[model samples]
Target chain A: MEFSSKLLEKAVNEMAQLPGIGKRTALRLVLHLLKQPSEQTHYLSQALTTMRDDVKFCKNCHNISDVEVCEICSNTSRNHKIICVVEDIRDVMAIENTNQFKGIYHVLGGKISPIDGVGPSQLNISTLVSKVKMGVIDEIIFALSSTMEGDTTNFYVYKQLKEFNVKTSTIARGIAVGDELEYADEVTLGRSIVQRVPFEISLKNN
Target chain B: MEFSSKLLEKAVNEMAQLPGIGKRTALRLVLHLLKQPSEQTHYLSQALTTMRDDVKFCKNCHNISDVEVCEICSNTSRNHKIICVVEDIRDVMAIENTNQFKGIYHVLGGKISPIDGVGPSQLNISTLVSKVKMGVIDEIIFALSSTMEGDTTNFYVYKQLKEFNVKTSTIARGIAVGDELEYADEVTLGRSIVQRVPFEISLKNN
Candidate 1:
């Protein structure tokens, strides 16, 4: 779209560079910023720039943090020996929300997607290998999504750690707790059946 | 959602303040920015802040501009005596794209909407009236949308300019170009029939 002012056009173009935002949406957002008080735009710009300049990652988990190490990684009560491998910081937040896992996380930053030109070397895999090689970890859990990229990353990391004396396991795949079994996909249903646990074991967990 | 980093949370919150963007979408956008190079974030922030701090509005028409007077308002070829009143710069851009109207525009900035707490005084209505009172303007066309607020704004402006000698009219309300008659709304179809133009007049325009 043609803009009357170069400044407006530049702002909209920059906003459109973001994923999922188009030129029209960028224009709308820029116009919204224009309509509001100048302080609103200042705050947004300041926050974004500050975050980009100062944001840090946990040295141990590779998750986003403001300090040298994240709270979960530094917490003495949690079991740091059991590392939960995941895609990004979002996954760490999701797992933390469940309050089920007491283990620390190892953020891979992203999955290994060759189609997108992202290889194993691009991710935070080397540090994780070194952590495992230190022989302080007891168990490693693969907590990535169920996509093909997730499986590929899991297998690649598992192969890298095979020579080392580390036990690796994947998160269980099953129908959602509130979902009907009839609606479950065939592959997931079949896997759930094959991986069924003992009746008493399930009772003991409850 | 819980964020490990305060800076990340602040950025996400600021991004979410934009219209139509929720917390989840904001988080996704902020994280995407983090994944990209620092220059991308710098450019985006700089553009938005510079636009907000330096952008100007045309003194005559109140359209967004970088100069004291907008290009359209300063153009000698366009008819200055005839003014088309619109809600915002987007409408100005839309009309300009059509290449039909040779008259200048007066952007109202917004329509009178009680629900949104927008009144005529808040918009650029006074300047338009003063321009009309100068006796240089021959005609004033109401080109706001056909919504209730648009109609209210049109009537309000019409009343304000009643004492002046300038002729007032509204943009025609009818079925859109290439729209099926069967699918047309009842009010618009009825208005189209009632305000039907002469057959020769339509032929001459084509």
Candidate 2:
């Protein structure tokens, strides 16, 4: 789309570079910013730049943090003996919002997707294996998505930790909590059936 | 959602403040930025900040510009005597893209919407009137949207320019090009019938 001002065009171009945002959407966003108080734009730009330039990753789990160690890694209340392996920080956020997992998180930053040029070496697998080999972690829970890349990463990490004494497990694959069984895909329904737990264990949560 | 880093949370919150963006989408965008090189973030922030801080509006038409006058207003090839009145810069861009009009534009910024607390004084109406009253303007085309507020603003501006020598006209209202006549709304169909142009006039464009 044509823009009257070069500055407006540049801002729109930069905004449209973001994933899922097209030129029309970028123009609408930039125009919205132009209508708002200039302070809002300044705050947004300042916050983004500050985060990008100064943010750090936790030394232990590779999760984003302001300090050397993330809150979960530093907290004494969380279960340090268990680490929930996740594909990225968003997964950690999603799992944290559930308040179901009390263990610390190991953010792999990405999964092992060779098609996307992302391999095992590109992730934080080495540090995790080293952590497991250090003998502090008693169990490693794989909380990655149920995708091929997620499975590959899980297997790759599992192989590295196999020599260690730690127990490895994966999060359950089943229909979502509120979903109807009839609506569940056949593969997922079959897997859930085959992996059905004892009646007493399933009743405990409810 | 809980974030591992305070800076990441801050950046996501700021990003979500933009129109049409929600918390989940904001997190996705922030995480995407985290995955990219730092230079991309810097370019985005710098471009937005610079545009917000330095962009100017044309002195005559209130169109966004880098200099005192916008390109359309300054161009000698455009018909300066015939001005198209639009609600905002986007309309100017749309008309420019069509390659139909060679006239300069007067961007009102917004329409007269009492429900939204926008009044005539809040818009660039006075400057438009003064431009028309300058005695050089030949015709004023109302190219605003076909909404109630647009009609009100057009009528209000038309009243202000009525005492002047300039002729006023509104863009035609009819079934869209290539639209099925049977499916056209009754009001629009009736208007099209009453304001039907001569056969030669309608056939000339095709």
Candidate 3:
């Protein structure tokens, strides 16, 4: 047996399955959790369960939210005409942390990666396009990462929504190659948004 | 305010407080849990509360167990005459993983660290001394780490148990410098237990 206790070993094995956590690291976490106060363990268990049970995808933008529409999408104060499109909800959180973007969000779930078999059809592209067709969307901002797949996805998205009569943009300025929006400091990301360009020219430069 | 969602941010912050898990790692874990079906979260939450609420310290040996006396302490196959003393329950779990020793365990709860204000009185050393005097215990093994403070605590335990006529031994000779028993692989550790020397010579030489 890799571990003596069945329950403890199970916990460690489960932990090791997580990204970036190896068997040894998983063992350390399980052992540490075993030593923690009962209250702390209880809190963790509650949090883990509640995270999924209490949260649901926002109907409009597909962002993980507690309510059906999500607070941002429901709020009339948010500029619904301007939609920020991102790879995942993590990007939405990253943009929200900056507190500069007054617009609501639409999470694409993932970027287009042909090698990995993640195509535009697999993502929330149709939802985004359909949202744009609502006619009130004056600007659809592409906030995808600077990776190759990100660029490919942005190009496809721009092409798919060109028939619509509105300005489609992307957050391009100041971001470097192979960078994620989640890791960029608030100041740089905020400045990048301020200098966002239209999809027609932004596609070549980005 | 660093997080867009207050509840999620609170949960991530709490997870980040765990050993080896930082902010980014915590966010990853929270997000991973959020993606899973609610059942997985329920399992984790239930396990946390059950581990805390169902398990209590064994009054006799101080080892964590489900019942009054731990499985190890209550077992007739295990040598009741020998008690392996350790700083925490993790040490017990480590030694148990080796399956080399049949003796019971005694958790000190903590070590003798004056800097952290952990003196001998704070530990369950008195209960250990009482066990030695009871004549049922034929041998007492110190299975703590090889660090300076671990050595100091071992010395303190030795002086207290010195008056007892029973054979006083310690599990050493297999571990290296700055290594905790919990981190040591099972094979090397099992070999170490077979090669433990007498407490007096072992503690002084190291």
Candidate 4:
């Protein structure tokens, strides 16, 4: 779209660089910012700049944090020996909300997707391997999604820690609690049947 | 959703304040920005801040511009005797894209929407009236949308310029090109029939 001012065009172009935003959406967003008070724009810009310049990651888990070490990693009450490996910080939040896992997390930052030019080396895999080599961890749980990339990353990390004496397990795959068995996909249904637990064991969790 | 880092939360909150963006989308965008090079965030923040602080509006037509007077108002080739009133700069760009209107534009910034707390005094209507009082403009065209607010704004301006010698007209309302008559809205179809022009007049534009 044609913009009368070069400054407006520049701002819209920069906004459009985002993943899902297009030029038209960028223009609309920029125009909305223009219509709002100057302080709104100032705060937005300041927040983004400050975050980019000063945001830190948990040195141990690779999750985003304001401090060098995140709260979960430093919490003595949690079982740090049982590290749950996941894709990113969002996964950490999701698992934390469930309140079922008492174990700490190892954020991989992202999955290994070769098609997207993201390899194992590009992720936070090395640090995790080093953590595993320290031999302080008792069990490692793979909590990544069921996508191919998630499985590949899990397998790659498992291979890296194969020589080390560590027990590794993946999160269970089954139909959602409210879902009907008839509607479940074949792969998930088959896996759920094969991995069926003792009736008493399932009842104990409930 | 919970954010591990306060800086990330602040950025996401600011991003979500924009129209149509929610907390989830904001988090996704902020995370995407974090994954990119730091320079990307720097450029986006810099552009928005610069645009918000330094952007200027044309003194004459109130259209967004880099200079005191916009290009259209400063141009000697465009007709100075004709003025087309529009709601905002987007309308100016839309009309310009058509390449049909040779007259200059007078952007009102917004229409008179009482529900939104927008009044004529808040708009650029006064400057337009003063320009009309100068007796330089020979014709004034209302190109605002056919919405209630647009119609109210047009009528308000038309009343203000009633005593002036200049001719006043509105952009025609009719069935859009390539629209089937049977499927057209009743009001639009009725208006199209009542305002029908000579058969040759329709062919002239084509």
Candidate 5:
């Protein structure tokens, strides 16, 4: 017989289904919660059910937000001339934590993974095109994953925005900064070689 | 501004309020739950609510249970004549894992600590005394913490049951079975010396 109640067993099973949480860890969490007072446990239950309720995605940037336009998109202080396009809201938070970029973000929901049947139509493309056509955009920094699908997504977005007079640049995928050449992975070395920049060709005196 | 919603914040707050959990850890847990599917989150919510609703304290031992009598108490295979008293259900679990003892358990709920305002009346002592008086008990072992309060509790219980003719013993407080003498703590060494057996007198070859 289980040490916990069936309800706890069910809850533990659900928690175990989450990314990286196993059944043992789930049991520990349930047991810990059980030791606490009823109000706290009730509050936790309420939050889990109500967290996604009444919450709408930002209509403008596709960031997970309660309002029509995300906070970043609505803020006038943010740079309107540059837009950082990303694959998910998680990336928006990742960039926001850096406190280095003042530009707003546009979430594409996900990349063009053909194996998963995710194509250009599956993403928020019409809105992006409309945003560019409305004119303040000078640069679009594509901060996407280095996966094959992300590259395919970039070309698709690039093709759609080529006519609009905006400079489109994708984040570089070569040897990482501070990496030793001898220990570098083959893929990185090959990409770095393929994307090599040109400078003045020097001839030896000998 | 945080990327989390109000409900998510509430859930994290509830989680952080649990013992040994902090704000950062709660945030990580909330994020993990958010990334999971709705079915999994629903199960976790149901579990939190049911933990209090379904699980009840076992009347026999005060261990957590869904039934009136816990599995251990109801089991006929267990030795009814011996009872091992403990502070909490966790202690019972620790002892059960050993599979060395076949006796029943009596949980004190908590030790007597005047500083915390916990006294004899707060514990399930009346039930324990009644069970002892049933004339079936032959041995009563006290497996408690080595703290001052635990000792005081042990002394009080021992005094209360002095009238009954039963084998009363405490779990040994000495250098542990696998401990290295060089690394033994002073308190453990002192206890071992005081409780020294007649090994030298009885087993001496000379």
Candidate 6:
């Protein structure tokens, strides 16, 4: 689409650089900003700039934080010995929302996607490995997704931690609670059946 | 949803204020930015700030421009005698894309919507009226949408322009070019039939 103003075109071009936003959506967003008070746009730009320039990552788990250490890592009540390794901060939020895990997290930042040029070194894997090598942690739970990259990262980390004698596990996979068994995919349903827990064990959580 | 960091929370809150973006989508976008290089976020913020802070509107038509007057308004090749009044810059772009109308445009910025607190005073109607009173224009084409607010705006402008001797007309409404006749709505179909043009006039455009 042709824009009458150069400034509009520049803003839209920058906005369209975002992951899922297209040129049309970028145009709509820019126009919406034009309609709003200038202060709204100022606040949006200020927030983003401050976040990018000043945000820090936790030295322990590589999660975003305001200070040197993130809240999860510094919370004394949580079990720091048992670290749940996940992809990013969103997964951390999702698991926290469930109120299921009592341990802290190790944010890998991203998985090992070979096609996208994301390798093990590019992620926060080395710090996690060094933490495990310190032998303070009792358990290391692999909480990454079940994708190929997730599996690859998990395997790479597991191999690196083989020298250390710590318990390693992964989050269990099963059909979602409200979903029907008939709608479950074959791989997941078969895995769920094969890895089925005893009746008492399953009933204990509730 | 809770954010792990205050900075992340602030950025997400600002992002969620956008038109269609919700908390979840905002979180996703914020996390994506965190994953990308800091320069990308810096560029986005810079572009938006510069656009909102420095962009100018055309003196004659109120369309967004980078200079004192917009290119379309200053182009001497276009018909200065015919003025096509529209709701916004997007409408001007759409009509320009058609390449059928050679007249300059007067962007009203918005229609008259009492429910939304918009009135004739909020629009760019006064300048259009003053231009018509100058006795230079021969015709004024109302190309606003066929909504209640659009019709009200059209009537309001028409009343203001009654003292002038310029011929006033509205763009025709009918089923879209590629739409099936069976799928056409009753009101539009009936109106199109009632306002049907002469066979020679209809065939001339094609």
- Across all models, the iRMS values in order are 0.6, 0.8, 2.9, 0.8, 2.8, 0.8
Candidate order (DockQ) = 1, 2, 4, 6, 5, 3
Clashes of 5: 0
lDDT of 6 by residue, A1-206 (tens): 78899999999999998889999889889999999999999999999989988999999888889999999999999998999999998899999999999999999999999899998888888888888888899999999999888888989999988888889999999987789999999999999999999999989877
Ranking by lDDT: 1, 4, 2, 6, 3, 5
* Best-fitting candidate, scored by DockQ: 1
How do the residues B41-146 of candidate 5 rate in per-residue lDDT, one tens digit apiece? 6767777688767888878888887778888889999997899999876688788887778999998978999998899998877788888777789999999999
Q: List each candidate's DockQ score.
A: 0.87, 0.85, 0.30, 0.81, 0.32, 0.79
Which has the greatest lDDT?
1
Q: lDDT by residue for model 3 over A1-206, one digit each (tens)? A: 34334455556566666678887787677667766676677677666666656667888998876678888899998888999989888888789887779999999888899887878888989988888788878898989987789989999999989999779887756666689999998877898788776779867644
Report fnat in order of the candidates.
0.94, 0.92, 0.32, 0.90, 0.51, 0.82
lDDT of each: 0.95, 0.92, 0.79, 0.93, 0.78, 0.92
State the number of backbone clashes in model 1: 0
Candidate 3 stretches with Cα past 4 Å from truth are A1-18, A21-37, A74-78, A112-122, A173-206, B2-4, B115-117, B173-206
Worst 10 residues of 1 chain A by lDDT: A197-206
Give candidate 5's whole-model lDDT: 0.78
- Candidate 1 stretches with Cα past 4 Å from truth are A197-206, B198-206
| Per-model TM-score on C-alpha atoms | 0.94, 0.95, 0.74, 0.93, 0.69, 0.93
Candidate 4 is graded, for docking, as: high
Docking class of 6: medium
Best prediction by TM-score: 2
Instruction: List model 2 lDDT by residue over A1-206, tens digit each.
Output: 87889999999999999999999999999999999999999999999999998999999899999999989899999999999999988888888998888999998989999899998889999999888878989899999888888888888888888989689999999888899998999999999999999999989877
Q: Which model is ahead, 2 or 5, in terms of TM-score?
A: 2
Instruction: Report the C-alpha lDDT of model 4 over B37-64, residue by residue, as the tens digit.
Output: 9999999999999999999999999999
